[model samples]
Target: NAGVTQTPKFRILKIGQSMTLQCTQDMNHNYMYWYRQDPGMGLKLIYYSVGAGITDKGEVPNGYNVSRSTTEDFPLRLELAAPSQTSVYFCASSWRATNEKLFFGSGTQLSVL
Candidate 1:
């Protein structure tokens, strides 16, 4: 089974364009998260979900949104993309939120100009 999958490995958008980065896992994980990595920075949390119908904002939640309607999918939405939002997006899943290791997707590289 695919542990985690993210579509459109690479995408380029003009300023103000919108897109959704899809993420899915077949591991039945309870915790799902979205993170963005900049050129020289560590992963920054964008949003997360503890379970279906439960989602919370992370360190940087502005310009993004997420929904957890099932244990298998947590999609990140960018309503109006900006150059500042361009980064490598990673989706991760873990059985537990405390100490469990996260299984990450390949990542989606987004560029907004």
Candidate 2:
């Protein structure tokens, strides 16, 4: 609901494997964000885009990347999956700024072994 949809709600990845976590919103929001939450930890920002073609790194971007080719799509890419990268990933979108209320996807649970 809320226009945010995340794919592959559950996934298992082998060490050194890679995948792209897809997120999309139909609300036409200009600001989209990617965040990851490790077990027992708060959500950590991974990447965000103010709009299509404008992307930027966030707090924990070292092992991840993202792209926004359209206002409705923002996908996070993990080039090399690792145990340390296993976590619940969330995608959110807002109409304006980060301080505003955001619509978040159900979440993607990823495990690396």
Candidates' C-alpha lDDT: 0.95, 0.94
Q: Residue-wise lDDT of candidate 1 within 1-113, one digit each (tens)?
A: 78999987999999999999999999999999999999999999999999999999999999999999989999999998999998999999999783689999999999999
Model 1's TM-score against the true structure: 0.97
Candidate 2 local lDDT, 91-111, one digit each (tens): 999998999999999999999
Query: How many clashing residue pairs appear in each of the predictions shown?
Result: 0, 0
Q: Alpha-carbon error at 67 in model 1, in Å?
A: 0.6
Clashes of 1: 0
Candidate 1 residue-wise lDDT at 48: 92
The 10-residue segment of model 1 with minimum total lDDT is: 95-104
